[model samples]
Target: MRWLCILFLAVLASGCTAAPGSNQTQGISQDKSQQGAGQATCAGYTFASAEREISVLAGPGNAIGNEHYQRLAQALDCLAKTVDAAKISSVRQQLDRLNPDVKSVSFSAVQREIEALYNAGNTIGPEHYAKLDSQLASLGQAGYDISALRQQLETVRPLAEKTATADNPAALKDLAAINKLPECNGQMLSDPPADLGDVQEISPLGNIGVPGHTLPTPHLYFHISAGRATTNTVPLLAPGNVTITSVTSSFDELGKIDEYSIGFALCKDVYGYFNHVKGLSAGLQQALDTVPCADFTDNPGNRCAKDLFYPVNAGTEIGRVGHLQGNF
Candidate 1:
C-alpha cells in the first residue's frame, strides 16, 4: 500500500463540510451513506467535503494470454535451455558401465549429468557443484571412490560457471521486453473522449496538499481526459464497458457547492475513480447514486456485487489494477 502511495497519488477531494450549524465530528456513517441519494436529502450524510475536479491520464491495457506466454518463453530461454532427457539417459548409460559401488555409481552419474546439463546450456550455478561435492563426500564416507568423478567435476566447473553467466544478460533482455508491454508502459495524458477534443493546461497530478507541486506522478490508475478544462460542460465518457461502483459527494462549507465522485468497476480487482467531476448526466448520476459504500478492507466485511464492464478500449480509460493480498 505504501508502494501504491508512492507510485500513484490516490484520490483526494477538496475538503469536508459538516451540515449547517452541526458540529458532528465523525466520518460519514455507513448507514447514512448507504442510503446514498435516496434518503430524504443530503441532510442524512455527514462530513461532506468540497470536491475538486481533475482528469487523469489513463494507462495501457495489460497484455494477456499470448502476450504472457511469449514473455514466459523468453524468460525461460534466458534462464536455462530446456533439459535433454534423451541426452541425459545416454550419459547415464555410459556411467552405468563403470559399475562401481552403488553409492559411487549414483554419485558419479549425478556429477556427469550435471556436466551434461551444463553442456546442454541448462542453468547450472556453482551451488549445483557445491551440493554435488557434499553428496560425494557423504558417499566417500560410505567407501565409494569418488576421485575419478571429482576430477571430471572439476574439469566441467568452468563451463557450469558459464551456464550461470547467461542469466543476467537474459534478465536484462526480459526486462526490456516487459517494459514494452502495455502493462509496464507508464501513463500519459490521453486524447479527448469521442466528442471531446484535446485538452491543454489541466492541473498536474500530485499530492493535493503539496504546495506549488504540479507534476505527473507514476500511478497505475487509469485516466481519461475530457479535453481541456474549458466551460466544465464536457461530458465524461465511460472509457469502456463498466459498471458504476461507488458514488461519493463532497460539499464546500463556505461556497455551498457539492462535488460528485464516481467509481467504475472495470473488471475483477480492477477499479477506477473520477474525482471532482461536475454536472454528471442524470443517467450516470442515478447509476452512481445507487452504489453502496462497500467494505474495501483486506477482509471485506460487506462486499458489493460489482457490476461487470467489458470490451473497454485499451488506452482510453485507465482502471486501478491491484493484486490480491495473501499467499495462494
Candidate 2:
C-alpha cells in the first residue's frame, strides 16, 4: 500500500535534469524597486562577505535546523539571483574548499534507496538484505539523522530475518516465483504539470523551511510570487495519464487559509501527490463530491479527504495552486 511519492515541481518531471532557474524570491519583498536595490547590494559581495553571511545564517556547526537552513538557503538563493553567476560559482568553490568535510546529501536519495530495499524484501535474498542492512547501519556514523530510515527498515526486518533464520523452502520458492514476474514499467510523463515560467524557484529536494518541514523532507517546493498566487493565475496540469485517487482539504484556523492535496496513481506501482494546492478544478471538485470525506482535524486546523477515482490525460488541467507555494 505504500506508494513511492514523487514530488513534481513546475516543469521538472521526476527524472528530468534541467538546471534550476535563477529566480528565487521566497521570504523576500516582492516589489520590483526593492528587488532591484537588493540585487545592487548583493552585486558587491565578495567571497569573504558571502562566507560571513552564510556563517551568520547557518549558525554554529552549520546545524540543519528548520529556521537555520531556511535562512542559509534564502541567502544562497539571493546570491544566485542577484550576484553575477561567476561570482556565485566562485563563492561556492571557495566554501567547498574551506570545508571539504561538509558534504551535501539529499535525504530523498537515501529514502529512495531504503524504500527500494523495503519493497524488495521478499525477492532480495537474505544475504543481500543483510549486506544492504549493514551498509545502511554505517550511514549513522556519517552523522545523519537516520531515525526515520531505521524505523522504515524495521518494517522490512521481520520478513528478512524470518527467511534468514529458517529453512523455509516454501518462502524461498515464493521469492523465486515473485522474481520471475515481469517488472512493472510505469508510464513516463510527457508534459510538465505546471508552467515553468510561472514558478519563481523550484526548491531542491530535502529543503527545510516551514514547520511541517523540520527534517529534510522528500518534497519539492514551487515558490511563486505573491501577486501571481493571489490572482489564481497558475495552472496545475496532469504530467501524465493518471487516476486521481485521493483529495485532502486542510483549513488553518489561525490563518483561515484553505488548501488541498491531490494524490494520484500514474501506473501500477508509481504514485505521486501534490500538497498546498489552492483550488480544485470544477471537474475534480464534482468528482470529489461523490464520496464522503474522512475528517482528521486538529484544533486550529481542519483536514478532510475523500478517496475516489477520476482519470485524466496528460496535460489536463486538474487544479491550480495559487496560495504562494506548492509542495509535491
Candidate 3:
C-alpha cells in the first residue's frame, strides 16, 4: 500500500464556538492546528504532533516496465562508472578469491599481491608500468570487458572484467557491452505481470479521495527504498494500461494538493518479498506483518470477498510495505 498525501496548509478555516459557563471550566487549548477540508474528507492518515502541516509526497512504486527497468539500470551503471565501478567490482573479486590453499602461503604474501592489484585500479602500478601514463588512464574505463560478446554465461567460465595485459583488452570492451545489454537491466528487482502464467485474487482496499487507494492481488510486488534521504517504493502497484476515473490537483493554501482516480490492477497470487528478503529494515518487516493474508484457495477469511491476503513470515504475522499496519 502507498500513501496518498494531500497537503492542507494556508486555507484551513478555524471556528470559535461558545465555551462552557465557567471560562476556567472550559479550558482554552492555546494550541493551533491546520485541518484539511473544502474537499473530500481527509483520507485516512495519522497526524503527528501539531506544528504546521507537513508536505507528503509519494508516487506509485515498482518499475513501469522494460523501458523503465533499462533506464534505471543505465542510471546505476552511470553511478558505477562515476566511481570507476568495474575496477572496483574486479578488485574486490580478486581479493575475495585470494585462495590460501597453497601450503605455507602466509596472509601477508596474499595481502601484498591483492594490494598491488588494487593500486592499479587507481593508477599504473609498479607491476604494470610499461604503458604510457595517458594511455593507461584511457584504458581503465573500458578495460574490464572480458568476452567478445555480451551476456556470456557465468557457468561456462566466470565472466571476468579485468584484462591481464594492455595487449589483451577484450575484458574491458565486454564489460561495457554487458552492462548495456537489455537483459542486464540492473533494476533492484523487476518481474512484470506479463511474466506470470496465471494471475488471480484481486480486491479493493477502499478509497483515498478519488484517485489514491490500494488493491490486493494474489501476487503483489515487493520492494524497498530507504536511507537518510526520503525514499519512495511502490512495488505493489505495477504500471500498465491505467483506467482513469477522476483526479484532483491544485494549490490550496501554501501547499500543493493533488489526487487522482486510477483504476487498474494485476492478476493475483500477490508477488512480493519476505522480511528475510534482502534490502529490508526491521521497521519494514513490522509494517509488512500488519497486512493479513489467508489461503482463499483453502481458507478464505471474512474480509469482503475481494480482499487479497498475503503470507506472513514464520512468526505468523502478516506482510506489509514500509511497515504500515494493514493494507492502506
Candidate 4:
C-alpha cells in the first residue's frame, strides 16, 4: 500500500558565511564566533543542542528513540535558518546513513536475515534466539512496529523442529511473503491530491530538512501560503474517495501549538496521510468524537484514534489551515 503525508510549516531561509584562510586556530575561533552570531539571529533556536544530542545518539551502542529523531528533525529545521544549502545536504547524507529506517534497508531484510540464520542449521539455541530477538528489537526501535512478525518468529522453535531439511523452505517462503505486504510496498498516486493552483508549493517525497519530518520523509508537504505570508486559511481537500482510518493529535513543541495528522486509505492497499493540520472538518471531528482515543507512543501528550471508517468524497475539504504562520 502507498502512503501520503502533508507537513504544514513555514519555510526558513538559509544563511552562509566564509571563514578566513589564515592561521588555523584563528580560523577556528572566527568560525565559532560566526556560528554563535548566526545562532543569535534565530531566537529560541535549539539547533546546536539538538545537533549535539543527535551526535550522541548516533554514537556507537546508543539507542536512538523517537524523541531523539524528533529532536533531529527540529534541529534540521532550525539549521535551515542559519546553515548553507551544502551544509544541509551534507547533514542529510549523514542522517540518512545514521537512520536505520531508511527505505533502502527494508524491514523485510531483517526477516530474511533471521530466516537465513535459521535455515543454516534448522535450529536455534538460546544464544542464537537471543541474537535474533535483538535484531527484531532494533527494528522496532527504528519505528516499524511489526508485532505480528515478532509473534510469528516466536514459533520458530516448533517450526524448525518439524522440518527435516536444513533449508526450512516453508518458513523461508512465509518470511518472503512479508515483502509483498501492502504496508511494505504499493503503487503511487496517479495524480496529485490538489490542483497546482490550490497549493503555493508542493515538495516531492524524499529527504526534507524541516521540522516534524524525518531524514527521508515519506509524504509530500503542501504549502498553502497567502502571498508571501504562511497562513492557514486554505482548505485541505481529499485526493480521492477515501476512508479516514486514523487521526493523531500531538503537541508541536517547536510551534508551541497542537497539530493533527490524518491517515486515509484511497483504496484497497493504497493509503495516504497528512501532518501538521490545525483543524479538522466537521465530518472528521464527528468521527473523531465517536472513536475512543489511545495514547500515541512516539511523543508524550499525543493521542490517536487508529480505527475509523469515515468515508470522504474526492475534492471534499477534510480540514483547514486555521492559524497565521501555522503548519498544517
Error of 3 at 4 (Å): 99
Please give, for residues 1-328, the per-residue lDDT of candidate 2 as tens digits: 1233333352347335434442444223346534543444443553346567655634553423445444444455576765556656755554443341344445666677666543321123355556445555556776766665654453334333422344644334323433343355855767777888877777677765433344454556666664323534478999788777667676522224666767666664555677657788999998878877543444333456556667889988998765433333
TM per candidate:
0.26, 0.41, 0.13, 0.40
**lDDT of each model, Cα atoms only?**
0.36, 0.55, 0.24, 0.54
lDDT of 2 at 114: 63
Better of 1 and 4 by lDDT: 4
Looking at model 4, residue 172 earns an lDDT score of: 39
Task: List candidate 2 segments past 4 Å from native.
Answer: 1-183, 209-214, 226-233, 253-255, 296-299, 325-328
Ranking of predictions according to TM-score: 2, 4, 1, 3
Q: lDDT tens string, model 1, 1-328?
A: 8987755653322135455445453344534443431222221221111000000101122223344334333432332222233433443343333322222326656656644532221222376656676667777787886664554343233332421345534223323322333442234333333232333223333322122112222122222333231223344566555444444343312223443444454444344455444445665545545554321222211111222122234333321111110000
Candidate 1 — what's its lDDT? 0.36
When summed lDDT is taken over every stretch of 10 residues in candidate 2, the lowest stretch is 117-126
lDDT of 2 at 171: 33
**Which residue runs of candidate 4 sit more than 4 Å off their true CA positions?**
1-195, 208-214, 226-231, 296-300, 322-328
Model 4 lDDT at residue 35: 78
The residue-by-residue lDDT of candidate 4 on 207-237, one tens digit each, is 3452323244444556666422544456777
Collision pairs in model 4: 1-182, 4-272, 4-273, 8-327, 8-328, 232-321, 276-328, 277-328
